[model samples]
Target chain A: MNKTTKSNFITYGMVIAAYVIMQILVGTGSVSSLLKGLLVPLCIYVVLALSLNLTVGIMGELSLGHAGFMCVGAFSSAVFSVVTVDTITNVAVRFTLAIIIGAIVAAIFGIILGIPVLRLRGDYLAIVTLAFGEIVKNFINVVYLGIDKNGFHFSMKDSVSLNMEEGSKVIINGAQGITGTPKNATFTIGIVIILISLFVILNLINSRSGRAIMAIRDNRIAAESVGINITKYKLMAFTISASIAGVAGVLYAHNLSTLTALPKNFGYNMSIMILVFVVLGGIGNMRGSIIAAVLLTLLPELLRGLNDYRMLIYAIVLIVMMLFNWSPKAREFRDKYSLKRLFSKKNAQKEEA
Target chain B: MSFISYLINGISLGSIYALIALGYTMVYGIAKMLNFAHGDIIMIGGFTLFVVMNTLGLPPLVAVLIAIAICTALGVIIEKVAYKPLRQASPLAVLITAIGVSYLLQNVALLIFGANTKLFTSVVTVPAISLAEGQINISGETTVTIIASIIIMIGLMLFIKKSKAGQAMLAVSEDKGAAELMGINVNATITLTFAIGSALAAIAGALLCSAYPTLTPYTGAMPGIKAFVAAVFGGIGSIPGAFIGGILLGIIENLSKAYISSQMADAIVFAVLIVVLLVKPTGILGKKINEKV
Candidate 1:
């Protein structure tokens, strides 16, 4: 196998081995309820980080509104699950459909937002995405929707304003959000999605479209001069990234019984947290993102014993990680003994031959 | 009458935004990086004021001065420790570090101040004025905010136009290598910029709390975001642009809240930003530089 495939295999093997070990622990009853409860969410966060990495690390664009896309996937899927719960009695088929719906809806929103936004560069693009993200969250909050024998009802004012027929089901109740969502998201499904995200992102990075996207990121002017359609490639990468994030959102919605859009959940802070994960993971390193997301997500929980010092420690770790990652002396140290360097040496020998 | 009242309120709010935007605009101009921690500096300033006036029983003026001093020192220290090392790093890296510093400041405040809100007593001593047969009464904070912002704006303009340090700042912002070659102290200028920016933030904190009358670790976050939008709206590096953007944004926000749904005011403001950016990509007064291939 080539260098790329070999590295990809290593990453996949690591995840599977980890999963098996975790399953053993879970079966043995060695894991606590708190840690066990955290499994699905941890996987969800890992997916979110990877998806964001596709944009910030590979596409060379900083997005400050990623959670908005997550929010879109969540609320849309929640609506679908609520509406279809009775008709689709099978939980697996129902969740599969909801995930598909969530992905499609999020992709549509991404395209709509991206077409206008991708025209801008750097900070402007970042801020514009932020604005659109806020718009989506705000729009969701004010929206009210329901269904009855007559038809579906919708309004922007309030749920009462939807004016559905008597005994009709209210799918969305604005701030209160959708309740009674079936928790079809299992840890097994979470792991499967993670592996799927890993497969797709890893394979795509080695493909022609992925190369085109990276080329654009490296030098937009040069890429454009070389006949790489900047607009098409940018939108394609952005849409794909958004859809992946949406899928994670689907997992998130299902993992919980009730899904609501709160600042802590779907706001800019969440986006920033995802960005932190991407950056800390050594941007563009897919395996690194997974590890970073897992570790950072666990950091706060691990520091829980310290009480007030938990967040304080988390902040220090973020800064220290940044310093260690980018500082010149640390880079030299890492390069001397890093597995990445060892792999590069093997690739160099192959190229020379 | 209500419309007139809203307009006045908008202007008052806009002035506070203007004060905050000035700091953002200046730091962006010289440092070429967004200091996300700048907003937290305002929070730090507010807590300093609280400690001084509430705990030490100091006069409001002394408390305000102490707050400014404390924030200025904190800003310089952060720049030296967290940001200076990453001067050669990627913008994204620097941005993340700034975020870390912001998080550190916030969590630290939370530890010391606790999570409960503190009621802020107004420091502005000016009396309220009634105009047009008392139909349009203006609060002391509003009058002081508008006048103070204008004065500070003019003063800053003169300082930039005439001061030697300001000249060094302009040179460094224009070209750091060239500025160093020309014997201008680039690092010192950056430190000065952060110091000035933090001082302005302290003043802004005082005024913001006086108007809103609440103190919490998260107080500066939302307003910081709005001021950032304002800085972008007016053209990030231009002082006059920040002032105009702040006022216009305030007016738009207030009018929308009054006439439109108050809950959706944030969305409307962001929509306006997107529209402006689409029309003028560099912002209202931002200069467009051609990309050198």
Candidate 2:
């Protein structure tokens, strides 16, 4: 427990330090425009990685719908921003409201999807989560929403029949998606959100409920026999994880001027990418997740000069990282370089004695 | 008449899914790994055919043979290089590695082919089958797909039931250690399973591209995932279950698209899996294994 907390502190320190350095670079005009464009996305990915790790790493359920929650958040927040754009002239206030709405909407969805899904275990849970993502993606494509003097109207057929008055606006344009969203999301907001997520996740990881969640992950049957309410705990972790992903979604939505719920952007590939972050980061390691998300998010962009070879290199990195992390030789090397051995040599010798 | 056409379309599509699901079920049954890269092999096969026939100007049949050969060899190599070392690793680790292999295949394809859809010419040429006084017509590709799949299924069944190598596959899947003790050559059996699975993927890819008439880098992704769902729905390790599940899922998806909202078809198909699993967690033909604490 002490070690865990200490590691969390170290992680927090590293993240804050990196944030400070990045901010300094940006302020001094030392950063490139390409990197500046990546800042918000980098933060969003970090949050996604952290939240996904909560369920996959701590809760031990592989959810393939983290992006679905993000989808909910993105669309919801975008809609909120659009609806209130005329009334709320202040971008900051509207953006905050958008984030809050997005998080709540996503949490509700998480509960709705999680209740039935959490009943299953392992691979079954994974497939169900995958289905949930597909359902969300497909659902968005056919849905049309508009707001008029009579209030909000929705349809599945065509966006033209949203029943809005002449002065009213179409919020969701079916497959065309929500446009003219206020791009008020800045890099600083993203960093702050990332910090807030880290703080909540870290504190939760050290809390009693967090222990219960981990206990359930370690052994579901044993945890249930010991009187841990599996449903409540699983729901807690899953919902919180979903909400955080929603927060990331809000961040992402506001970063862009137009938000679309396209399969390419919010589908299996995106979900899998987030899962890759969690898995490659050493599931359950928050610091590692943050690092992996940041590094991997930057990698493709860094390799953009190579054009087509960027993704190829990314794929190679994925394979190599997996091998290094999981292979027996790598494990032996990790053991050799472990901080415990370096820091506690006297204790180790005493134990040997 | 339209209904019959839809049914034919669904059946043809389902057969392709079944072909792919067979490989998935076989690999899962024997290797006990998800082989997430299996779908990508379908893309590789299609791309190979496109290259051989379009670029190299080879005959369609010879192009298909080359594609099958490439996929089979690639599948064996993947198992040997990526999955072999991780046999003793945790399920999560192996799953991630499988995903990595999938990413590798996709990105490699993306780099080579770009993201644009490539038009693929139909390889099989047969007369359309008309029924009900021409009210219903099944395309030549659909007819050929259904018949070829049926023949393949029968041939695979016979091989598994009557062939020595097939028995070795069964034994290995049943108990790898025990199979090794019985001199079944477990690794060889696994390599053979991957080889056969990849070959099936090649056929499925050819039929799918010809039916759809467009091949993109990600053309196999949706089908791959849907096939995985079918594999699970039928019971992950059950051959007949995968077969039945694939056809049923295909029919359900198409019928839903025709009768209900076209947009909701994919969701409805997935919903069926969820409903089925809720009632029967191990799936339709899945055997219940006791959990060890």
Candidate 3:
């Protein structure tokens, strides 16, 4: 095997090892309760930030509706888990089926949303995505088609009806929110899912498809001239990013065991927060995105004592960072030192040895 | 009668949107960059009026004047601090900075004035004016909004066509380099453009607050986005086009909400934008520019 391949394998092994160790610590109560609380959100946010980085940073598309996609996944999974586990006798089969259903449903919605809005670029794209997010939230809020019988109106209430009963109707309460979802998201499961998402995203970024997406992002006209199919690649990035966001949403819903109204989950503020993470992490850099996601997710929790002042401080920090152009070191390294030169130097050193 | 009143109400709301759209258009014309924070400036103006009128106990009219003046200054400051430095940067950089400025201003407002909504009472105490068949009645707030918007739009048109400074702004918008070579102070002209745009926005904010009466830190976001859409719909760089576009968008959105479902109103508006773009990418009034690569 080539040295690069061997090194890549080692790196993957180390990452897997680290994830396993971290999972064990959380699972076995080896870490402090506070650290565990911090780690859970951090892991989830890392997936969110990295996935968003692929779209906004690497693909140079500003998507402000990522949270909407997440909401899609979360609700879809929650609904599936609620319906399927009751019908299926086997526990493992039910759980596996729910996850597959959730991810697939989210991916379908992602493609549906991506096709139209991916054609818009830059601020226009941002605005359209933002509108889409709001629209999704609103749509979820008002979509109440099921019956309103005495003592039990929607699927949420206790009508004592079995899953898939002839008389039973699916009803999503508008603005009142979806509640009483089953919490099946353990630390191990969340970590595994995050790892898988990271692997897929990293692999995609290294592949030819990823390069083409980046090319389109850099110069759409040129990419189009070279027959790179800008619209298709843009949609691909959108779908992939949306699907990852959906997974994060599923984890969030299962972890919380309750969700506010659709609007609550998929609001403009959530979208902005996601964008902020992408920006704070040094846009387009995977490691930077991961670090930023973790830090930002924890910062408010760390400053909980400050109460109302926490968001104020958070805003100030962001502004100061932006004003100073305080980017992560990895970004500077990538910009300053070309990959070709670094690889050539390493190759020369190997020859000398 | 109430339905007619709502219709009149919609038109007045549309007028304020048109006023705000002018600011978006003017800045985009010169910079070719959307000033995403422009709506925040309107928020600042409204908050400033609140501070001056309610906090300091000034007369409402005086407070509004003070807010307008402050917003004009803030506009100049925003241009210098956030936009001018990144003048040569990629459009994306400037756009991001604008977003940052928007967030910065919003958070600052949130810190100063908590998240709770504030009330801004109407300055005029006159009763609603009734029109034909007693079906259409204009509230004092609506009348003020319409009159103020018309006066402002006409004054702006006259200034751009007649005044020396206004002509300098026009010249700068047309070609900054040539305008600079022709002895126009480009920086001052740009600052003036911002000032005028922001001053107009402040007036719109005051008028809107009077009509609506509730204010929040993030309230400007939707209006900002809508005004931007209006600007683009009218043709981003055209002043008159912005006014027409803004009014049209406002009317369409209001009418859609009134006739159709309110939830589908935004979808319809965006659909219109998509259709318009598909037909005329340069927009209704926007001139096409040839690029040299």
Candidate 4:
């Protein structure tokens, strides 16, 4: 096998080993409840950072509405689960269907948002995506949806004059959001979803299509001259990135009993925070994104004892990490210590022998 | 509220948006960076004003000056420390750094001010004035906001038209390398642009707090984003476009809130932005850029 493929297998094995170790620790009652609660979130963030890297890092497009797609997935999946809970007695089946529905809805929205993105570039594209995110959040705040024996009912206005059975459930109550969602999500499920995301994205990156997307990112004009259909490739990466985010969202929604469309949860701030993870993890580096997402997620919680200084310390770390990663001296140091060089050196020595 | 009253209120709100949009557009024009922390600078200005007037019991005029000066310095420091190094970096890298700076400012403010809301007294407090036989009422704060915004606009226009420094700024924005070759001192001009933009943010903050009467560490964020939308709506790099865009955005936002669903107001505003962008990507007054192959 090639060196890169071998390295990829090593990384995947390491991740599986880590997951197994954590699960064993939890089973032995050695890990804290707080840490256990963080496990699923950590996985979700890894998925988000991974997906975002595909767009921001690999595809060379700046998307600021990743959280919006996550929101769409979360709400759509939550609604689906709520609607099916009565008929679909099997929890696993219901959740599987919900995940599929969420992925489809989010991918569709991704395409819709990605269409306008083709015409714009740079800051303008960023702003348009930002606008899309804001619009989604704002719309979620006012949209009321519910399912009953009377079938589906939705209205922007508060009064949803639907005649239903006495036991009808309100799926979404505007700003109050979707409540009593089935909490079937487990840490194991989260890890599996993240694995799926990594598998899809990693495989894509090594494929011929992936090379075309990267080629476009490296030089749009050059790629166009080579007859690479820019729009098709861009959409492929973007839609996939968004759908992966949707899976993460489904996992997130199921983890929570109640899901609200608060700004803190699904707003511009959330989008920016996810982007921060992708950027700080070393853009276009999947392993870096995973490492960054895991450590950064854990860092804030570990510093909870710092009380008021928690966020302050987090902010300082973000700035320092960015500077270190982007600084010229740091780049030189990284190049000198790169794993590729070490492997190549070993290969040359073997050849001489 | 009466239609005229809503119109007046929208105008006042629009003026505030215009003020903030000016800062955003100026920084974007000359520096070619979003300056994401521009919004946080507003919060700093508001807090500075609050501490000066409310705690130290300074005169309003002096308090305002101190706030403006502080924002101006903060702006320059941010440019030097965070932005200057990234000047030649990719737009994505620079944008991320800006976001980092923004987070730092916000978290620092949150650390100092705590999470609770603080009451902000109006900078302009005159007895209510009645117009059109009591059909329309204009508050003193609203009047001050409208008049001050107009004055600021006129003054800025004249400055850009007449002054050497203003001409330098214009020239630099037009073409940085060409301006540098002409001995325009691009660094100093960029620094000056940041200072001016930040000072405008301070004024906008003070006015916004007076109108809203409550301040939080996050008060500046929504307005900042809206003003950015205004900047883009008016053609990102155009000064007059920012002015008109801000005012138009304010009116649209307020009118939608009053007439349509209040909760959907933000959604409607963003939809308008999307439609406008689809129709006219360069914005109403933005110059079309041709990409060289």
Candidate 5:
């Protein structure tokens, strides 16, 4: 097999093996509920990191509004499930529909925001995306939505302004967020979504459009001179990345009984955390992003004993990880002992044997 | 009269934003990476001032000076430890490191100070200015912040235009390799930029807390972000641009809060940023650099 194919297989193998081992641990009751509960969030962060890598690593854009897209997806999907809870009696089917709704809505937001922002140059996209995220969060805070026998009611003032009938129900409670969100998200389903996301992201990275996208990232002017459509590829990568993040959002929303767009959950902190994962994992390396996400997400929980020091250690880890991934000496050492070297060495030994 | 009051308040807030944006613009100009930890420096400055003034019973001038010195030292140390090694790395890597430093400072502050909001005593003891038969009242902070920011802006412009070190900064930013060849110490220039920026943060923090009168661990985060938006609005590297952007942003935000919904004012400010960028991508005062093939 060719080098790229073999490496891709190894990436898949790593994920599947990890999943199997986790299942065995669960089967034997060796894993605590706290650790087990972190499983789905682990998948969510993994997906977020990978999708962000597509923008920051492959497309060569620093997007700081990823949490905004996630918020959009989470809210939209939760609303969908809430509206269709009685009509769509089947849990799996309803969840499938919700995921689709989330992905589409986030993709639309991505496209709308990306068009004008992407046309600009020199850090405009980054700052603009950050502003967009804040705007989304701010807008979500004042929004109040309710449903009555007649139809839907929306208001920006308060619940009293919704003017719902006697039998009406409020789907969204403004700053209180949506309650009664059915928690159907499970470890197995999250893993399936992660695998699907990996397949899509990895395949796209190795495809023709991916090459065009990377070319733009390498040298936008040169890529444009070579007849490549710069805006088209950028928009495509951004939209796909947003949709994948949206799927993660769907899982996130369903994992909780109530989904609120709190600053802690859907703020710049979350976006920066995902960026840290992407950077620490070695940008553009899909498998590395996953590994970094998994490790960093679990690090704080494992350090819960040192409650106050948890964030401090996490901060130190961020700095150390960046150095390990990007420092010159570290890069030299990593290059010298990269997986390709091991793979080639084994092939040479087999030939000799 | 109320409209006049809000305008005066807006200008006061804008001056503080201008001070913070100067830090962001200077750092971005020389180093070409957004120092995300800059906001935290503002927080540190406020806390230092708080501790010195309240806890130790130090006077205002001494507290301000101490805050500036401490912040300048901290900025230089952060650059040396967290950023210097990655000077040759990609911008993204440098940015992530800046973020790490920001979190480290925040977490450390939280550990030491706890989460309660500190009621900051205003260092500005100047009496309020009452206009239009007391229909409009402007505080001493308004007078001081506006005047101080203007003086600092003029001083910074002169320094950049005339000083040897400032010229060295311009040379390094224009072309680092050429600057090095011409015997300029690029590293020292960057360190100086960080020093100036952090010093500005301390001053801004003093003025900021005096105006707002409250301090928290995360106090700097939002205003830091807003000033960043201001910097970008003015053109990231242009000093005058940062000033104009800060003023305009403060005015718009204040007016929107008064006339429009208070909760949506943040959204309106951001929306204005988007519209402005769409019209002028390089920003109001940003010079367009041609790409060399």
Candidate 6:
């Protein structure tokens, strides 16, 4: 096998091995349950941050509504898992079906949203996506398919007919959130899914299509001159990124079991928080995004003991990180330890041998 | 009667949106970059007013002036720290940095203020005013919003039309490189632009807080997005267009919520934006220019 193929295999193998080891530890009761809970969310967020990096970092598109895609996945999977009684009989079947359904539903919404808005550039695209995100959240909150005596009935479809008199069924429960989702998401499952997502994205980034998308990000005009179809690639990035975000959403819903009643989690702030993770990790660097996502997610939990000052310390860290990058002294220090030379030295030694 | 009041309420709300949109349009006109944190500046202005009025026990007018002064300084600092260094960076870099600054300001506010709502009573209370139609009464607060917005709009127009600095601002907006060649301090001019934009945002915040006393750390996000929509709806860089667009958006949103379902109001507004963009990308009052090769 070629060296590149061998390295790719090794990376995948290592990731799978790490996941398996974590599972064994969790199963054996070696790791704390709190730590395990933290790992589940961290794994989901890594998928989210990395998926978002595909659009915002790699493709140079500013999509402010990624969480909306996640919402679609969460709701879709929640509804499907709740309705499907047979899948619960087998754990493997249930997991596979939920993921497949979540990814598919998210991809569909991604395409639907991407078609019109992807044509816009930069700030315009950002604003459009931001609006779309709000629209999705509100739509989910208000749109009721029917009313029944039992509760409110909600359908994923745009229109549904129901008898209005007996009792009202509000599908989304208005300000109230979806509840009673099957709690099948475990640390092992979350880690496996995250690893699979990372593998897919990494593979895509190294491929020719990925290069074309990155080229478009660097300079749309140049990429277009080189015969790249900008619209197609942008749509591709949006759809794929959105689908992965959907997977994260499904994992989140199942893990939490009870979704928050408030629209608090699906707002612009959440989107911005995810974007911060991407930026903090260093955009366009998958490893950076993964590390940043994990660290930032854990940082607050780690500092929970600090009580009122937890958020204060968190804000300080964020500000200091931004200021440090912008400071000239930091730049000089960064230049001294440039990774380019370090990697090049190893390559040169291998060539000499 | 309550529904009619809500209609009037929507119009007054739209005026505040118009006020904020002016700053967005003016900055975008000159810099060609959306000041993503413009809304947070408004939030800061509101908090400044709260501190001045509530904590310091200053009179409303004096407190407003203090708030404006602080916001103007904050605006200038933001421009210098976050934007000036990246003036020539790719649009994406500037955009990211703007978002960073936005988050920085928000988290700072959250850290300092806590997440609970803050009450600014000075802006919220006013006796109701009777209209000519005895059945149609208007709140004194709504009247103040309408009058204040008009006065501010006219004052800005006169300043842009007659003042030297305003003329220079217009020139810079027209052609930055050319204006610089003619001996304008582009950097200082840009700072002034941010300061003016921020001051207007402060006023809008103060007025909005009068109408709605509840202020949270995240209060700015939706208003900021709405103001941005107003800017885009009117024309990204058109000052007058932003004012008109903001009012129109406010009216449309309010009326739709009152006449139809409130839940669909957001969707309707976005649908309108999408249609406007498809029909006229440059916006209602914006001028279209061919992209440079």
Model 1 misplacement above 4 A:
A328-353
Model 1 lDDT, residue B195, Cα: 96
Top lDDT model? 5
DockQ of each candidate relative to the true complex:
0.62, 0.57, 0.32, 0.56, 0.65, 0.40
Q: What lDDT would each prediction earn against the true structure? A: 0.89, 0.88, 0.75, 0.87, 0.91, 0.80
lDDT of 2 by residue, A219-336 (tens): 8899999999999999999999999999999998888888888876798778888877776687898988998898878876787777667556656666777677777877889888
- How does model 5 fare in lDDT? 0.91
Please provide, for model 5 over B1-293, each residue's C-alpha lDDT reduced to its tens digit, 9 standing for 90 to 100.
89989998898899999999999999998899899899999999999999999999999999999999999999999998888889888777777778789899999999899989999999998999988898999898999999999999999999999999999999988989999999999999999999999999999999999999899889898888889889989988999999999988888889999998899998998998899888887779998878797
Q: Write the per-residue lDDT of candidate 3 for residues A1-353, one digit (tens) a residue.
A: 97645644664575577678887886787887777766656666777887788888778877777887877787777776665545676756665666666667777877876776666567677776776676667666655424323322443223333234456555455555566666677666766776787678777877899899989878878888899988788888778888888888877877776676444457867776776777778887666676677777777677677756654555555554554452344346555687887888899999999
Better of 3 and 6 by TM-score: 6
* Candidate achieving the largest DockQ: 5
lDDT of each residue in A108-198, candidate 5, tens digit only: 9999998888986545677788889999999998999999899999999999999999989899999999999999899888888888988
3 versus 6: better DockQ goes to: 6
Q: What is the lDDT of residue B47 in candidate 2?
A: 96
**lDDT, candidate 3, B1-293, per-residue tens:** 66666677677878888999999888888777788889998899889988888778988889889988999999999888777766665666667677777877888898889889998777666689888867677889888888888888898899989999989988888898999999999888888888988998899888878888899988787788888888878888888888888888888888888887787677677667756655676678989876543
Over the stretch B1-293, how does candidate 1's per-residue lDDT look in tens digits? Answer: 98999999999999999999999999999998888888888899898998899999999999999999999999999998888877887777777788789889999999889989999888899999999999999999999999999999999999988999988988988889999999998999999999999999999999999999999998988788788889999999889999999999999999999998887899999998888887887788998878878
lDDT by residue for model 4 (A157-199), tens? 7635544467667788888889889998888888788778888
Mind giving the per-residue lDDT tens digits that candidate 1 earns over A81-111?
Answer: 9999999998889999998998899899899
Expressed as tens digits, the lDDT of each residue in A1-353 for candidate 6 is 98766766765675577678877887799987678778778878888998989888788888888888888888878767765644377767986798889999999999987887787888888888888778778777764444455544555334344435554433444455666677888777887887788788888888999999999988788889989998898899899999999999889888886664235677766787788788788877677787788778877677676655543444445445655566566567777777987788889999999
Question: For candidate 1 chain A, which ten residues in a row score worst on lDDT?
Answer: A305-314
The residue-level lDDT of candidate 4 at A299 comes to 81
Q: What is the C-alpha RMSD of each candidate to the true structure, in Å?
A: 3.4, 2.8, 5.4, 3.1, 3.1, 4.2
Candidate 4, residue B150: Cα displacement in angstroms equals 1.3
**For candidate 6, what is the DockQ-based docking class?**
acceptable
Per-residue alpha-carbon lDDT of candidate 2 for residues B1-293, written as tens digits (9 for 90 to 100): 78888888999889999999999999999998888899999999999999998999999899889999999999999998888877777666677778778888988888789889999988888888888898988889999999998899899989999999999999998889999999888888999999999999999999999899899888888888899888888988888888988888888888999999998999898888888888887779998888777
